[model samples]
Target: MEPRPLSFYLLAAFFVLFVLFLYGPTLTIGILSFQGPEGGLTFPMRGVSLHWFRDLFQEQAVGDIWGAFRRSLVLGLMVMVTTVVVSVMAGLAFRKRFAGSAVLFYLAITSLVIPSILVSLGVGLIFDQLGLPVHWAGAGFGAQLTWTLPFGLLIMFAVFNRFDKSFEEAARDQGATAWQTIRHVVLPIIAPSLIGVALFGFTLSYDEFARTLLTSGSHNTLPLEIFGMTTNVTTPVIYALGTLTTLFSLLIIGVFLAGVAIMGRMRARAGSDAGKGV
Candidate 1:
């Protein structure tokens, strides 16, 4: 075999450093989370134990972590469903030219360039003016949509842009209605992409801090609660919380990826059966 180029070694070293830069902090936090009862936040482990993890379950002197987690989970699910549905609909609508389509599309994505804290503040002020309560499920939800929807719309737009019109033509040739075409043909083909959009929506909303800061009202979401904890709490328990949340985020990503894989396999099997029948 030919000797590898020097440039290849350089790129490989760069990639390794990039990976460490990305995950080194998380790895450190996970390790420190296991520090014994007497352990400090920095290195030089006193010993190893689950004491900090247990402390997480005990009464907290600061904010309500579990309550915040529950709120975040519920909000994430809400955002995921809304993002998928709205994104798919917007993608379909934009596929056909309508009056002011360009203007509307630009308006939809304008939020992407806006500062998140400004969005949060704006939404809060709107709620106050309208005699509505600013709340995590209310104003907070609306603000987060401004952030997640643009991403979801962008993903769906790309998916549909490359989508084969032949499938829809074939479905119509078989007497499928417009809704039927979308439900049976378009949706199934785009199922995996929707899962990806859902993943983005959930994860982004789960970890969002700025846009949720002012609009979440009195009830803190997990990110906000963690921020609050950082100010007052000085213990390995913080690391334990960080480790658990990181693991939960990974679990969510894993579940979404598994869903995508399952759908891919099902689609493949269906294609094979169709080929056999043909």
Candidate 2:
């Protein structure tokens, strides 16, 4: 290239600033989390040690951090599984038009327009009126589905929209039943998209705060616990928690990406073998 345009440099600078704006706080927290025992939250690193990290393991005044983490993990998994199943089913169903299909589809996604805090309140009120105890696994789970399911459905819709029906037709031509066609053909082809949906579901549910606020009842999820910590706990331990959770989130994303990569390779390998056989 002879010379790059001035606009290119401007755009590159803008992107760099955007990345800094996005991740700067998290990076700062990660650095501060390594502070020595004497280190305060603000910065000016006193000494480098795993003091705050150790403090997290031997916690006291702050709320139940580990318990909250466990609850968040379990809830994330539950939401991820439900979102994947419901989204896939809804996608398959929507492939064929039925009476009131359009109406039902809009209704399913109506929750996306509603405020999340209101959704949490509504779920809590519903549970109270129904004489059922509001709990994280119950009300929190339902409230979070309202957030995750719509995204999952939207992704599935896009996936199926671009999906070639000839594959299913071919499977049927080979004497496969409807369930067999879905199991052996449709699902395998959509596996990567399902992983994407699961990632959305899990990450959304795990980091959800407003929707889980009123619905989580007595047991706080990790986000709620972290919010609670901001009020009273003035220590680097919070930073340590943040860093660890951030790492865990990244790990989960990496695992899903790795799964997608593995799936793509397997499909490619199978295709090559089939071509050779042909």
Predictions in order: lDDT = 0.92, 0.93
Q: List model 2 lDDT by residue over 1-278, tens digit each.
A: 68999999999999999999999999999999999889899879999999888888875746689999999999999999999999999888899998888997887778887888899888888998999988999999999999999999899889998999999999999999999999999999999999999999999999999999999989999999999999888999899999999999999999999999999999888763555656
Range of the 10 consecutive residues with the lowest summed lDDT in candidate 2: 269-278
Candidate 1 residues 50-122, lDDT tens each? 9988888875544588899999999999999999999999889989999999997897779887888899888
- What is the RMSD of candidate 1? 1.6
TM-score of candidate 2 on Cα atoms, chains taken together: 0.95
Clashes of 1: 0
Residue 64 CA displacement from its true place in model 2, Å? 1.0
- Backbone clashes in candidate 2 total 0
